[model samples]
Target: MASPLRRHAKLWIPLAFIAAAAVAVWFVAVPAESDGDPDYRDPTLPVAERVADLLDRMTIEEKAGQMTQVAVDAVQGDAVAERGIGSLLNGGSDALHDTPEDWAAMIDGRQEQALDTRLGIPLIYGLDAVHGNASLPGATIFPHNIGLGAAGDPDLTERAAQITAAETRVAGVHWTFSPCLCVVRDSRWGRTYESFGEDPELVSQMATAVTGYQGEDLSADTSVLATAKHYVGDGGTAYGTSETEDYLLDQGVAELSEAELRRLHLAPFEAAVDAGVGSVMVSYSSNDLGDGPIKAHADSYLITDVLKGELGFDGIVLSDWQGVDQISLDYAESVRTAINAGIDMVMVPFEYERFIDTLLDEVEAGHIGTDRIDDAVDRILTKKFELGLFEDPYADTGNADLVGSPEHRAVAREAAAASQVLLQNDGDLLPLTGEESLYIAGSGADALGRQLGGWSGAWQGTVEGVGEGTTVLEGIQEAAPGADVEFSEDASAPVVDRDVGIVVVAEDPYAEGVGDAGAGDHDMRLSGVDAAAVDTVCGAMDCAVIVLSGRPIEIGADRLDAIDALVAAWLPGSEGTGVADPLFGVTPYTGTLPVTWPARVSDEPVNVGDPDYDPLFAYGSGIQT
Candidate 1:
């Protein structure tokens, strides 16, 4: 009934009010300034002045405390306050107690003590949330790096990092050691599956994108801090040279020339630095330049002279666990060398008192300059400030419910679906929708403990009661609700006259160099036990074989020809159920081979850059429905 002009005026008034209200809410929720000037300007303020302003309020002991990171096992809430410890880490050997609430409570208690320190500096918590929020009980676990490489979508990799950040925050963790940028050149290395691929371009693309997952601006977010790790040439190490008593372990020497090193090992790190990665962890392997292992904690040429000066990286440089000790047998000497080398933090997970005492002695003797100590402290403090720890000093236990929540699990399922490579499905045995009963065989089929793979409940992974984990047997039951799943340790176990037979074969559960050592000199052939088992199973029933291993193994042509389908499910973590998504028709398989699949051990260690390049399955090759 009103005139057109009057009607327009009435509509515009409410819309203007709504917009004004929205702006007001944002400003109120996120305050512009707390205790200081909103637009603080101090061009003349050296990094030390800015650091000293914060440190002046801190007690001497509290200042000393900021230099160390203790393992979670060694902590008690009151001890953190008493010693003024600056950081805590859940090493690969540690695990969260059953519930997310329990995990959060543990972190919250430590934070409370850190806040109670004289200066009230917040404590930084770190963990190896390498593939997902892996340490917590119910946290969603993604496929290892190899699977991620096959997807070849940087945007998706970034999204995965975002999801990892969100879920990790919910579990009371504020940092993740992830996005391993190592360009793996040999399949014989134990941690090959942890790398994205053999090419520097692919590794760089995936690793750089992950920096976005933790948020481009760390100053105002609760998202986890990301670390680009095992810096420089860990993946190019020669076979049988790792430091482990076992010949095949992880800490080995890389054999590349200096030029080859820059082309392959250095590119990903350059990209990571450009992406504003918060930290870098040094590798344990020695470089080919005769520098011994680049002992990140004491290599001035690599850490200070190159990374900081040449590359222009400004983030904190942390030592891998126990790496500082490699500098000198005398604890005090080790402390001096590592600090002089420009390491901002020492992850002396144990023996902290010794390190602290030795460092104090070095400072008094003038072996390590106070200025150098102050420089390292400033770097550490600047990072903590940038992370907004001063404003919010405690973990939010209420958010613990988000760990392993349905949303996170869904992401893992999506990753697994995307990562499953259909190497050979000759008779269309996969997507087995109509099979009445699925006869499942092999040690891994019923082994929940082994299915989770390394770094789950232990450093090298465990075989017995390795905490609560899911098995592929359970995954199959969930996938094909009506089909019967039979399990067998001995591959020749009597079949129940099933319509389809599935044999899940695995290398006896081992991690890193231990797994590599067992495969000795062979051209990727299946072990005698595994081969005998596969033959026994196939001879007993009509079946398909699914390999659950760290890398591809060559099976005899006669043995491979007997199978109707073959799938490479490389250590698909707690969400084994996700693997079945491809086996069933729920999701199409799209993953390609991230590493070359050699036909035999004699044809070992070939990478994409090699001239001949003959392989059982070429890099980037996959099958899709």
Candidate 2:
């Protein structure tokens, strides 16, 4: 008889041969079409000729319409077809459905309407897939960039990006707003987790890797387009200032000098552009360079002169949602300034009609020239041609099963496993046995709404009436089937008497900067009722604390020490169950810290580029079994 290992190898030998034969047969039977044409490079073609060859073939309204992007709820099939809206985006709270099939169907229906247009320019669908296609159900959610920074592996970062791209395309989305290259200088900023690391070099390198993984050749591959976003200094915004007075989380103003800004923040974008990124999204944050915050949107110097000319960027430059509105207090003036500044696409996500009217009126009134419109249109058309949307305007709905398929789930599972950092493990208490009676506490443990975080199912991160998601509680229950389990929010559940207790603590879901910084929102440190909850739970029984958050918070070393084990599971999306693999001994805890944990609130506003830098935990710091 063969040894067990030998037997396993012997069994796979025959199967491997069959797999190879099958692949060869499949490729031979279904050879891909060869549109073997020499590279066509013509820059001198008139914009009218280019758009007309594309547009003359298109009806009157279709040519005028491909320029607009509307929200999913606001658009009808007729409007999408007649107006020639070339793109659709799912903003905050917009979801096709909870399942992958539903998502594919939703996109297929939209694409069908788009093909009905005269020119049949395939509608480009986009979403903020910021952290692992967070909008799609069952899409793997990795730890935000801040956590990845602590892990400090460029190879791992690239793998995460590849997984994100694959899964996003699986969901029928071709464009992803990701790899935010902002070098976060302040933790108080809401979008801190969106950045890879605080170091400009690190952010640049990681951003380039992510862009590469998303693929530069969209024409031949099903890979999605990667966008390096919030172009300029959004992370260096001064505290207490925001673009809108009603929400502290909206676009704010950066306070860096031009030299510092370029040296620290702008460096990553340059790297992204060089990597052949498909698009660049302008930041809403105001800069002091020449004009001001709003001017950055339409500033010819920055958008045209700097980004396009100096940096040699050739991709689409899109504004943030309704970001063009800030160009001026006057609606028409705002449209004119932004267009003249160099915006190629307007995400007039809401009220697109007004934007269209304003742009046309401005041109007729001489406030904005037709040449400027032609320039913007030319850039937009060039990108569409490059993306090969002109030839193939439809997605492969026959492969609809690809959405959230097993392959995607496997990648997401790996990311989820890699992203969790074992912050503390006293007495080596982790890898809880399946037989152990686990008592779970905190709102995050059983709540899917809390686990999904901001920009999911809702614009403002509100989870109410938002539909369904897998919770940490469900995950633990599934991992330890038939094991005694109990949950409580008040810390008074009888399950505390169980053999082991797990307390899952999380911040109220929020996006941008809406979550308060001082009192009500969240403090880096475990304080107020949260601290009280921890203290109460720990005092009642032996326990481990798991933090589910977008950013690391300052927790007293003593408090962290008191818990038997501590895990940083940064916003693990619908697959909260994936977290159980590490918790229940199925997978070892291997994720390292992606960002430093602050020992105190005063330690914050710490930048990796700071001269006097000292951190509670160093970047790339993590504990593993």
Candidate 3:
């Protein structure tokens, strides 16, 4: 029983050891990092070499532990260190977060626990950060992916991602679950805004966000690992097939032919891999390969064969939250299936204790192989080495002040302005010149929560405890200083006499399964207060209906005729000024429809190229001037 150092001390290359020590001393001056473990600590060696050295030293327990990720609240005291946990994730809108300093402190506290382990291996912290670090207050809330798709400028998408990376790193987070590569085939899916568009080509183009996230080198302090999510065919799930009670289709069953899956759903992932994305998240949905409904979590052929073998994705493959649990009837079997299926890391979230025990039991029973564990941990460790997380494990708080800086918001505004699609301009009523008074009406007119959509400060995004940002009403006032712009929640205000009326309406914000349209039972239309407000405003004055929604709503032919102009402002986010820019002619309307605008809710899953295509507004349709 000799110490590993004493045993391998004779094998250590003296020159390489000296170079590693030099690297440790050199990198420590800027951001404090690892100074121990000669072979792993040495920055001069190839990442592969460093990873191999570290792997040989880990015990079976530690190796198994490296693949588990749990929520921040799941661990207490020194338990995380005791168990040798490898990663921590702060879920959307965690109440513990108050300020950047507090966030950084939490990360440091966990990291300290992680460092106290036998090998002092550091943990990688992650967040949703899908749109400009949504979990943090004062962080820039960029337009959702559907809007970015409408803008169709990969350069802008990359720039926004770069800013997201910098801001996220400042908050001490090193990984972002973003650039949701789901190519939406159905607009009824609640997460439509999360996708670039219905077209695979469009989704592939926007994978530029991967470049923005990883930058040229992940070793840089500013870069964060980007994730291409819901692998294979999350976006192609057939309507009405969802089993998550009351839900329909989202994360349900995808029955796409292998060719269609590769051509459409899998195309964007290829672009992401080309950009060197550090991770891929397996989809919660099931894909039927002629046998029966098989969850992606248990699909060895897809995860290990298609993604890892065929696509050549060398990065880590992560599981969605609680995804493994749904794989089989028993937790231990589920754990075994998901692991052997090629998921490198399991986002166990709240049940890490159970997950850890299950995995250990599976390994001990020979249900799961040590070779598989080694492979998974190797990929995980390789990324950590590449991220330079071992070199600098602590949060970089220097750019904390840049969370919602003017420069980042400026880019958000530009993105918002470019995403607006003017569907109709019957009387050229838009571009209000400030020469005439205007009236603002509808639910979303002043709702910052609605404009930002889902996954903003919380998972099921809401107005309650929202971050600081401009509402559409505020943007209107700012855009036309000389003109009289008044807002009435229900258009019941005294001054009904106005040159023009702007009615804004939205679907209450939603995220994933909870936002589904159960067999089209969920009406994608402006109803109740929203519809009444639309009528009141259009009745009082020549009106332009500014639709702030994730996808096309059922504003039937009657409603369309009532308004003089129509603009599809798909969840423009915090910068209401971006919407105002196009509405007031500050910037011309350049956005085209990313998905086909349906004429009714019954045309639920309609998109471009459907036979007998009769959309209210076709994909790529937009009015100029």
Candidate 4:
């Protein structure tokens, strides 16, 4: 028999080797940490490893809290630290503003409370900077997406996003709910202006906005996370399906075959993912892919199989505001279904505690698997780590001066010029001499609020003091220094008594869930006053009608014949001078129609590739002098 010492050595040597191998595996999964103590706080480690370590340290409640996003107003009474809320969002319209400096203070206070939490996770704040840093007081409001779509210049589009990102960071926001990638197939859809037009290819090209938002290094001081929103198809909703009271196409059903859906709706998201978009907000609308109307917020095939498994989007999947609540009658089951469907973050804008409790209880009951919870938290925490919020959680207050700077306004002007589409110019009426006595009159002419459209200073973009910006009349006057310029909100004014008449008509400001044209039933006709304004003004003078709207409306042959020129100036935002730049020989007319100009509202759903492809002005139609 062997000696006792020899027998003990053999057993101890194998045990030591096993322990060493396990340690090696841990290091490989995580990045190298200092002193080999498995420290997640080590800055030198890869983000994945740090995320893994932090995730492992979190309890179920902490992890669930990291998945919850609430409105800032709801964060009352120790909620930020006590509840471990992961993020905060100021909706399209929020009651939070004292000054630019106050915005920073508000953000920093919440951040301090977040840092005081058990795990010290920072809260990411999001807002709708759709145009510029739109909701902010001094930030430049770039042209709405429809204008950019008509401009069709990806470079200009990207530049607009870059300015938006820089200005948003200056205002203490970490994310922007912008670059609405919904390919608008129907102009009647209330949210048509939010899209990049009805082409998958165009939307895909514009997805470069992600690069401008996050920059090459996501952790850069000015970088804000880009969101590819209304995932799947919010734009393709079948008309008349909206359940919203007094709302139409905003959240209607998307009725398309899987092939059609894949071809059109999913194209931009693929590009967005390729461009490294950090988040995708699931649509509130439903989709019927040859089966039945199923909400995208809880569709396992849409959220999990297609978005995650097939496309390989590793970013967090966020739900729209109160989106999960609408998925099912039983709120608890809605939480379970959305989680299992691969939503990593819940935008329970209100009632966040209920959302957290339901998710926590669901996980404990085995209704939501532990693996799912881990995956959800993994994505959310990974983004926070990538954002470098751990190393620097406070607002970079120095950037505050960047808001609405002259340089940024110059960029917005460039976009506004590039986005100006010349839809009609009969008798070479454009390239305005500026030498001609010009009469400018219309409801939208002098109204900056109407020019900027919705999501400006307030939710619906009320026309009252819609932030600082030059009005269209002011811009035209600047362009036509040689010509006598006049402005009148009343179209019936004697402005037609001039060498050339310029009439501006506009759709009233509207936003999501409210602007729908009531199912497919559209009155392609312009609003009564505006239409009469066109006839009253154009019928008298050699006038050029500038339709300042989100999308095309009915301008019948009779109406069309009344004007010597027509320009589709889709919601030109704050840079009104950019519109003048192209009109008065300062810049050439280069933009083309993004959407088909229908002859009548009866041509309810006309598009480029439709079977009967007749349009008042074909897609890509633009006339230059």
By summed lDDT, which 10 consecutive residues of candidate 3 come out lowest?
A: 26-35
| Winning model by lDDT | 3
Rank candidates, TM-score, best first: 3, 4, 1, 2
Segments in model 4 whose C-alpha atoms lie over 4 Å from true places: 1-38, 93-95, 241-248, 495-497, 519-524
What Cα-based lDDT does every candidate model obtain? 0.73, 0.70, 0.86, 0.84
Model 1: CA > 4 A from native: 1-52, 56-62, 75-79, 216-222, 241-249, 290-294, 464-470, 482-485, 495-497, 518-530, 540-542
Question: Candidate 1 vs candidate 3: which has greater lDDT?
Answer: 3
Model 2, 118-149: lDDT tens per residue?
44567888888776666765556665676566
- What TM-score, computed on C-alpha atoms, does each candidate reach? 0.85, 0.81, 0.92, 0.92
Compared with the true structure, the alpha-carbon lDDT of candidate 3 equals 0.86
What is the C-alpha RMSD, rounded to one decimal, of candidate 3?
Answer: 7.8
RMSD per model, one decimal: 14.9, 16.9, 7.8, 8.4
How well is each residue in 1-625 modelled by candidate 3, as lDDT tens digits? 9999888877788867899999988555333324664587788999999888888777777887799898988887786798888988977644357667778899999999999876788999998989888888888888999999999899999998999898888888899998799988887787888999999999999999999988998977679999999887888887763354554577788886778888888889998988889999999999875677899999999889988898899999999998999987888889999999999999998877788888988999999998999999999999998888888988878778888889999999999999999999887887778668888888898899999988888887885427889988898888878878788878788646688988888878887866677533235778588898888888778999988888888897887899899999998878999999988899999998888888876786787888999888888999876
Model 1: number of clashes? 8
lDDT by residue (236-286, candidate 1, tens digit) is 877663354535336677766778888989889989988888888888776
